[model samples]
Target: MDMTIDAIDARVVPPVALAYTKALTLPHLASAVRPRFLVLQPNGSLNQANSSDFQHGLESILEQATDGVIVDLLWVGSLDAYGIAALVAGIQRATALGKQMLFQALDAKSRLALEIEWAQQQESSVGAWKHTFSSNLEAFLDNFTHG
Candidate 1:
């Protein structure tokens, strides 16, 4: 996995800037390529105040991503109804665009909040589709790499 988040042009496309530990690497052409994680991490707090910015950035990331996107929720201090709405919108857009959106590293509080929000979105007893993982590496290994 790539330890440095360098070389990506910030002008052309803004990188997902955040402090992180694990990155996901998948095989490319039968070789282990460096993990290029494009995760959307909330800066400061996630609430009604910054929902629009978050939503715009997320949509842009999803649009530019070739494989998909990884949303890192570990640093989010809090989540409100507006934040939930923005997140749902981003996921819905990704789905409509046929892009995979993986959410990872959710703390207990964040996980519960998301679970509640997702439950509300579901019309049936069957759960709605949630692409979540313990870590970005786990998501890549499970979804992309062949054992």
Candidate 2:
């Protein structure tokens, strides 16, 4: 099936809320075809400070999603030790259900740091997770749309 991903920039509360609203409004966004996957880009906003709230939002979306519809998440933010633990916990939960969850850092330095931390805390298999570091949104969109 052809994949359609709605790339949402959840940088603020309103946009985060709007992302969820837009997912629910999928029927109106396109004609005939419903989205095969929902890829969430919780950039900068998803952090240890707001882990609980972020998890709640994700859970809500998961609960509402149709069966077989994949929820692919990329969480990016400045994470403290505790926040990183929380993020890992969330990733584990998603993995248990066979969901596609990625923990990405927006910067190269942060990405390297996260990779080391993830390797140390490797609760799951090495291939079970993935990471990405890029600031270019348009390039991502073009590749995503074409591929």
Candidate 3:
């Protein structure tokens, strides 16, 4: 059965044409063991259809990371529960290893989704939970990596 949907949970965010875009990663800090900035500059909606790809890509890249991933949701025009779950899963992995994670450029709806899901999980907000709304990216990464 083929059906059409009118909108996403993020009604304010205009819908974007789904594209086969992958998250782009770069080494933000050289000396740090953890705090690797895994930027998710995806060019498509992080929805149910692509959650697995997002999660796997994130985890695969994260496996090489030490501290946390810097999820840049600047290009993510749409987000759903599954996407949030994937993000949380990565955060859970980082937390299990006793490290903090950070994300930026997230919309309020998506951010709220994460917060609501986080409240339900009841996990320690140690590694991935500590968030600084605004700061110089370089300085933040430096401060994030050190104790």
Per-candidate TM equals 0.55, 0.42, 0.58
Ranking by lDDT: 3, 1, 2
Q: Which segments of candidate 2 are over 4 A away from where they belong?
A: 1-35, 43-45, 62-77, 103-105, 123-147
Count residue pairs with overlapping backbones in model 1.
0
Q: What stretches of model 1 exceed 4 Å from their correct place?
A: 1-37, 124-147
Candidate 1 at residue 99, lDDT? 76
The whole-model lDDT of each prediction reads: 0.60, 0.46, 0.61
Better of 2 and 3 by TM-score: 3
Point out the higher-scoring one by lDDT: 2 or 3. Answer: 3
lDDT of 1: 0.60
Question: Model 2 over residues 51-75: C-alpha lDDT tens digits?
Answer: 6655554554443333212333334
Model 3 regions more than 4 Å off: 1-35, 123-147
Backbone clash total for model 2 is 0
Worst lDDT run of 10 residues, candidate 1, spans 1-10
Best by TM-score: 3
Give per-residue lDDT, candidate 2, residue 147. Answer: 92
Cα deviation of 103, candidate 1, in Å: 1.6
Q: Report the lDDT tens digits of candidate 1 across residue range 68-124.
A: 667767666777878877887777788788877777776776667767776676635
Worst 10 residues of 2 by lDDT: 1-10
